[model samples]
Target: MLDLRSVEIGYGIMDHARNQGYATETVGALIDWAFAFASVEQIHAECLVTNLPSISVLEKVGMRKTKEVDDRIKWILKRNSVNEA
Candidate 1:
């Protein structure tokens, strides 16, 4: 079963939006909102191995690589608790 306290995020924009900072900004905002308003403990994102742009966006939002499998990579960012980094 799917965990209600964790969620995965994904997005894509039109060709005209490529190279703009919208993706990074939006992802960062979403993560911040999730941690602040939702009861979530972690957020996850994944992209194809060939999709460097997607990987960079995830990194910029403080998500670190958690695993690599086949042609894709997984990333995760956990809510920083009072006693944890």
Candidate 2:
């Protein structure tokens, strides 16, 4: 079962719109919204190792590697950890 304190994030950009920062901006905005507007304590995301763009988005938004299950990497960001200096 999914944790009540956490939510999973996912996004897809069309082929024609790749690399224009939509995925990164949208994911970051959603993270901020979740932490600001709800009781969410953490957020999770998963992407394949070969998905460079998705990896970049996750990193840019301050997510950290949690684990690798099979061929996918699990990433996470906690509410207390957002915008840390």
**lDDT of predicted model 2:** 0.89
Instruction: Give stretches of model 2 more than 4 Å off.
Output: none
Residue pairs with backbone overlap in model 2: none
lDDT against true structure, model 1: 0.82
Backbone clashes, candidate 2:
0
| Model 1, span 1-85: residue lDDT tens | 2278887888896789978999999998888787875688888888999998998888778888888999999888888731242
Q: Candidate 2's residue-wise lDDT over 1-85, tens digit each?
A: 3588989989889999998888988998999888885679999999998898899999999999988889899999998889781
Candidates in order, TM-scores: namely 0.85, 0.93
What candidate 1 gets wrong by more than 4 Å, as runs, is 81-85
What TM-score number comes out for model 1?
0.85
